[model samples]
Target: MVTIEPIMIKGHFFTAVTVCLPKTTLLTISNNTGYIMCGALDVGLLNSRLVDRKIIAGRAVGVKTIDELLMAPLESVTYEAEQHGIFSGMTGVEALLQMVG
Candidate 1:
């Protein structure tokens, strides 16, 4: 199953998506500029192999829901995310604010 919904954070609008597979789920919250995702995201690949894309994204591990993902500290972030002041250990909400601020 797949679910997509609008989310409001500090008056900013974003999109939250949830994908349910056989035994695992994929979760992500995104705005126009960037996004934060669950462990399924590959921060390393975004930083290395796809560096040119300048994708601003972060990954949080052990999160089972979109709310957990938003509250959990990031395990890793893309280099482009770093450039935007988003870092590992920053909560998803904080990183998201930085993406728009």
Candidate 2:
């Protein structure tokens, strides 16, 4: 089963998605512009190598499971994100707010 719901944080609407599989649930939270604010601790996100010409802030969590990523502390971030004052060890929500600011 998959569920996607709208959540408001800091006056911004975000999409929260959860896909339940046989033994795992894939979860992610993103802003309206499709910038990933939080996601599972997957290699695709953790050690992402994709580089774009535009400087989009990206961040990853340090959870062992997908669900834990929801509240997990930030583990890594892109250089552009650093310029926005987003840093490792901060919560995902904190990073998002900083990015919006």
Candidate 3:
């Protein structure tokens, strides 16, 4: 199953997506500029192999839902995310705000 919905954070509009697979679910919240995702995201690949894309994203481990992903501290972030002031240990919400700002 796949679910996608609009989300409002501090008056900013974003999209939340949930995809249920056989054994796991993938969760992510995104705005025009960047996104935060569950552990399935590969921050290392974004930073190294896909560095030229300049993808601004963060990953939070042990997150089962979009809400948890939004509240959890980021386990890792892309280099582009770091350029935007989003860092490991930052809450997903905070990183998102930084991405927008």
Candidate 4:
């Protein structure tokens, strides 16, 4: 697993990570607004992380290769995420909103 410190992107602060397995790779990104998971990572895995956090979390799809994960379009999102106007098919970078919380 490779992790990055929270960095500013599209006006939001996000911590990006990539996990490599024997046959697949997964990406996880999170910010004050929400979390986004790509590849085979399960959204349920984030429940514990969300218990004390007010941010939303969702899954991103449309990725045919690991390299495309960051730019891939969203496939499913949580209600809180939708409130930010992040919808299915929106790119990860485009879905992010400035942190206000």
Q: Write the per-residue lDDT of candidate 2 for residues 23-61, one digit (tens) a residue.
A: 556666676333443444333443356535334444454
Candidate 1 vs 3: which has more lDDT:
1
Clashing pairs in 3: none
lDDT for each residue of candidate 4 in 1-101, tens digit (9 for 90 to 100): 55465657656567777767676667777765567778464545443455344447567764544346567887776655666676767776666552233
Compare the candidates by lDDT and give the number of the best one. 1
Scored by lDDT, model 2 comes in at 0.58
**lDDT pick, better of 1 and 2:** 1
Question: Each prediction's Cα RMSD?
Answer: 0.5, 3.8, 0.6, 4.0
Estimate, for each residue in 20-87, the C-alpha lDDT of model 3 and write its tens digit. Answer: 99999999999999999999999889988999999999999999998898899999999999889999
TM-score, predicted candidate 1 vs. hidden true structure: 0.98
Structural similarity to truth (TM-score) of each candidate:
0.98, 0.66, 0.97, 0.66
Between prediction 2 and prediction 3, the one with superior TM-score is 3
For lDDT, candidate 2 versus 3, the one ahead is 3
Model 2 stretches with alpha carbons more than 4 Å out:
33-48, 53-70
- Model 1, range 1-101, lDDT digits (tens) per residue? 99999988999999999999999999999999999999999988998999999999999999999999989999999999999999999999999999889
Taking all chains together, the TM-score of candidate 3 against the true structure is 0.97
Worst 10 residues of 2 by lDDT: 38-47
